[model samples]
Target: MDVTQVLRMNGGDGDYSYSNNSLLQRKVISMTKPIIEEALTKLYCAMNFPKTLVMADLGCSSGPNTLLVASEIIKSIDKIRLELGHDKPPEIQLYLNDLPNNDFNTIFHSVSTLQKIITNPSCYFCGVPGSFYTRLFLNKSIYFVHSSYSLMWLSQVPEMAISNKRNIYMSKTSPPSVIRAYYEQFQRDFSTFLKCRAEEMVSGGRMVLTLLGRQSDDPCSKECCYIWDLLAETLNDMVVEGLIDEEKLDSFNIPQYTPSHNEINNEVKKDGSFIVDHLEVSEVKWDACTGYNHNLSEKDTQGYNMGKCMRAVAEPLVLNHFGESVVEEVFTRYTNVIKNRMSIEDTKLVNVTVSMTRKG
Candidate 1:
């Protein structure tokens, strides 16, 4: 699906307005800042001489978190300058990239707000809007690349998997053919992404990417939760109730692209463009319950709203089979299901961040 088509189908900016709320965005920024800082330090160490550095945040959505990455990079550069006792700061260029349909208005406004707070004279900022899976940066030009909560989205799912005879992904049981198709597509997209980055990044440059991932090597294992199923079922329910077209529900399929750690490593190794430096997986716990209800205690509401808001933003893709009028209702049902599931004490989500360095 085209990014712009998806955004337009969901009411564009109106559907995405909630993403800019400060309270919701802080959670993402807090989780992501340290990862970016560590990557920047490594990149700085790898640089042979001080020159203008180009950094891009691929798939950076419209929110405070987008600018937070830029701010953290600038701060790390300043820290390096201070430690080296240099009179002038290092020249830096920052690129904030997302799909063409992203809320650039909010992003530009956030950039304006950030400019007032950042006093560095050598920093330059620009927005590069496009799909990362296709092409993002100029060839052999980027010095550092960072993408979080992106890359997991494939350009599109394979056609064979959606056929009626197969119907593998739609089934509740873990179908081997379906799982293999998904893995193959992920490998293709990820390899393309790495090859493109390999062409764009300078030798010895560093890249850090973080996204929602599963821990299992087995493709059919339940360890990886397919979130689209929940949304699909929700839309299916609406169809049964005559709220949506059954044919639309039948025709729609979730866009596939979640790779296990082993899958990612194998693809990276096969590409032979980047050396894997760090691979870490952390189980992130989120309170989906606190988001829909403001009556919950502030202390209990520790960034659950951010996850909820992300779910809301992604609901369009999940509910694309349904009519636009039922979009909100479908998301409400999905959120309620998530909240109920999260009520269990052991419920949590897993997030993985992988860092790679360009081979010289």
Candidate 2:
């Protein structure tokens, strides 16, 4: 299956749409604000505050979080411009980029609201429909780049990853070859990403990228691996119940990999086009967006909300593979699995934030 054609967050403004359920991603964008500020500040100075700042938010799924990143960038640079007492703010030409199937209409329609929120720097918004794994802009055109909760998705699932069998993602039971395939796929995709961005961004261009990541070198660490593990277990349960085919369970694998901080570092070094300026790992609770109470009684609510969050992001891919018939039931059971696990341990996600500059 061509991942570019099928993979996208649930769109529109309904209950399960990414626009409504993306608080987790919004929190991630918020967490990376300081880094964004610092990167843009230096880039603005390095470029002598160009008249027009060209920027792109890669993998910008539709939602409040879509424009939230733009607002952050504008606010960060606008603050610096004001502090320096510059009479004019740069006109910001921002591109919102994602796969072709993303809800670009929602994003375009929301710009009026964004205009009310941003006063200066006259931002022009346009949606670029394509994969970030390939070139999406003119050479040396973009001055700044930002991506959040996106890079962990590989361009495609590694062919050998299906050999992982029963498990949907990297787990303790995955053999060495499956683990190696995932990492190798990540290395290739990340290097290609860096190479593409390097050509598109001008010298001294700055970028801030935040993605789901792992703290431990072990690819199977719970922080990054458990979400998929739980979903796989849920699928296995369904197979036993005769709700889903066992062979179908064996064939499906999430086209994502959460890398260690050092893995990110190694990819940057190997890519050779960007100099890593800052790299850090931070952890947030799985249910960070929901005001979820940990009381035993509140478990069901937490489970329901968690399932909605995951489904909002995963539904399209899941629907494409498993069909709509099982989507609700799948997440319904998956939530119970998560709720049960919550009773035993706290669930958290590890995020890796990297700030970089294009080599002149």
- Which model scores highest in lDDT? 2
lDDT (10s digit) by residue, model 1, range 1-360? 454446311222353344533333345456766776777777777785466899898878766667777888788778876776776777889999877777777778777778788868778889887778777777878988988767777777555544422121434454556666777777888999999999999888889887767787655444445445555566667777987677766656555555667777888899999999888776555543244446666543433453356454565565454546776677667666555554544455556678898999
Candidate 2: where is the Cα deviation over 4 Å?
Answer: 291-299
Clashing pairs in 2: none
All candidates: CA RMSD (Å): 3.4, 1.9
lDDT of each: 0.67, 0.89
Give per-model TM-scores.
Answer: 0.86, 0.96
lDDT of 1 at 357: 89
- Count the clashes in each prediction: 0, 0
Candidate 1 residue pairs in backbone clash: none
